[model samples]
Target chain A: MKRSIWAGLSGAVCLSALALSGAAASAAPRVELQTDPPLSQIEPFSEPVIFSLKAVADDGQPLEDAILELLLNTPPKTPWLTTDFPVVEGTMLARLTLPAPQGEAQFQQVPPIRGSYQLQVRVSPRVPGTFEPYTDLLTFQVPENPVKYRNLAILLSILLLAGLGGGWVIGGSQPPNPGEVASRPVQLVLSGTVLVAIATLLYISITAERAGAHTEAPTGQDNYTEPLNAEPVPTNITATLEDQAIATVGQAIPLEVELTRAETGEPISAAVLDINTTSLEYERTVFDFTAQTDTQGEFVWEQQFFDGAPHLVTVHVSPAANSSIPFEPFEFSQRIDVTGVAPPLFVRLVSLGYCTGVLALGTAAGFWLRRRSTQHAL
Target chain B: MYSSKLSTLKRAKQGVLSVPVQAILFLSLGSLSLWMLFFSSYPATHNTMHQTRHHTLGVGCH
Candidate 1:
């Protein structure tokens, strides 16, 4: 009787061990990425870099139905002309699929600028929830473009020389006679306008510089700071825009971003959110800012759209520093339509006004000098 | 001889007048060029001169 009992207990223990091993074997597969010409050899503005990627299961079989999403970000501290018209050359997004026969996919991209670029890749099976998702952040460097730097230097030198020589020649000419001066009222008005214009230009320059100084690049390192021993658990987070999708140019458009847990329908409060709006018509980033969710898991802000084109708005969500949740970071993007209107009149007037003022001052000085020299000759 | 000298000076003054004209011409050309290179949104022009616009001229070009 004792021998029979020992045999039955041993069989049950063996069966439980086999079930645990099977569960471990069915876990998510790993993704392997290789770059042609290697990432280290890439040069800015040179030949494009090719990436070869594959997803393989724990049993070493390639997962042919896997999908790969790639996002490349620009370098830090890039200065933009305006929040309305942003540069789009250095950033890109691509989605690729692995063919059944090859079991591997390839992507090619050219680096436009010299700096460290952050490439985020996410791999998931074709069928949702069939297998776990994998996320990876890879960084690569591209060397500076020497030829471009040299050309820029040459151009600047020519401009500087031309400006100096022109000023010297203009100053050497005679001036307008004081006795032939215009009416005092007209003179006062003109002087006042010029002074005000000069002050406005100065103010614009200073404020613009200060604003530019505040923009910093979003680094991937800061996005993912999970403890080394901590396991990455996927969070069921969903973001939705709760306002109208259409906006008018130069009018404040309300944007309300709401975050919620997909599983429990609970609000995910205090999460860090990064938002970027890029205009498809201009192929430029129109607006980008970072905000944190409130107690209700909502972020609300208003901005004036500058163009009458479709804009892509992307939101990236990450866990807050003090949060105990160890969820992976994710992003969502949507398109918003903007109705067309005439561009702002104030910017156009200011730029043209400043240019005209300088030209007029130079011309007036030249004529004044000519009169003075002619009078001296008499 | 006095009239001849006066004519020469007058001719020289006329030549000097062209200096201002030439100067104004240079000024206009430079202004237009700078605007196109740094400020204008001419396709590929801003991207090509991106570094110079930001580092040298301190113009914002992101």
Candidate 2:
């Protein structure tokens, strides 16, 4: 049970890492200088700069409760850049530890006079993981404050639309006119009013939906380091026969090979892995393995082999052309010497094998249920 | 007078033949009602566990 829990956690972390590795640069966490609205130029003293920095863990997991320390260079005219003060030495660091649920930190940095002040923001994680801290340096000026609009235009538009729609609906049933055909003007006016009301309702609903679209904190914003693909560049390949545990001459030994892509290290599926042996008996004993790759480039295979002699395992990795990335062929082998032990002697081994088979069957059933539902939807 | 009496008798026989047609219409209406009720609720009771999110991980694989 504990092993299973560890496996689940590891799987989650692996998926998170893979997702973040492909994230774009704009999604990365960085220090931003915020005014009431965005400013093109910064002037001195007139506007106060609000420093905001958000960090997400490298594993793509949220580091909810972490400490954010702020630092700023003093006096606005310290010769700190050239030689006197290094980046860390001249700045006074303030400890501002933020609690959980917010997972955000903001601070204000003001210089005596804004010439060219460098703002430093650092984030440290408080959880259990090997992660590098995040730091960003941003330079901005204190800009002149622009005249603030009272936002009366937005309010007036809303009220006008509402009043028009309400008046039409509250007027109730139209007067009956059984004696004569309705005139063109009356018909046109009625249709125009109804169309305008419908358009207004649709606009309101669409705007509300757009605003509600952003529900969760942005996962892609964390500056996740890209992965360096380590394709065990095959050097010298060698294999020797190790000790063997064997069954009857006709019985089959199952073997599974999983190959991942070289670039993203994601698993590549349906690529054939070959097995060679000194004797034809060993080679023919090899059964083809099943292939499947999950969302995070992971897969499993099931196959059986039947041979009493030493056997070799070789795996080749390949990817579809349409795939985002391709995998280079990787070859490795393990040799096993077989003694053809009697079937009566391995009761415990057989029982454990049965248990594993049961578990695999259960997993397959779960997958099948999901597949059927998807078909129904289609 | 005798011809008028015979015409009245033929009209009564025609009315008797229309009884089975009325019964057939009622049966058809009942069958239609049963079908609508049964099929409409079938979707409401459908098991959701059978739904799968697995397609060849196209763009959202990560």
Model 1 residue runs over 4 Å out of place are A1-33, A38-46, A54-67, A72-77, A80-86, A89-92, A99-104, A112-116, A125-132, A170-378, B1-29, B41-62
Candidate 1 backbone clash number? 12
Tell me the tens digit of each residue's lDDT in model 2 across B5-52: 989866664443232332232223322322222111222111110011
> How well does candidate 1 score on lDDT at residue A247?
72
Q: Residue by residue across A251-335, what tens digits does model 2's lDDT show?
A: 3333334444444554544343333322222233232221223344443321112223344443334444445544454444444
Those runs of model 2 whose alpha carbons end farther than 4 Å from true positions after fitting are: A1-33, A37-43, A57-62, A74-101, A109-111, A128-131, A143-378, B1-62
Q: How far out, in Å, is residue A228 in model 1? A: 56
Which lDDT value does model 1 have at A118? 74
> Candidate 2 has what TM-score?
0.22
DockQ scores of the candidates: 0.07, 0.03
Query: Pick by lDDT: which candidate is best?
Result: 1
lDDT values for all models: 0.55, 0.36
The TM-score measured for candidate 1 stands at 0.35
Q: Clashes in model 2: which pairs?
A: A27-A221, A43-A142, A43-A143, A267-A297, A373-B50
Per-prediction TM-score to the true structure, in the order listed:
0.35, 0.22
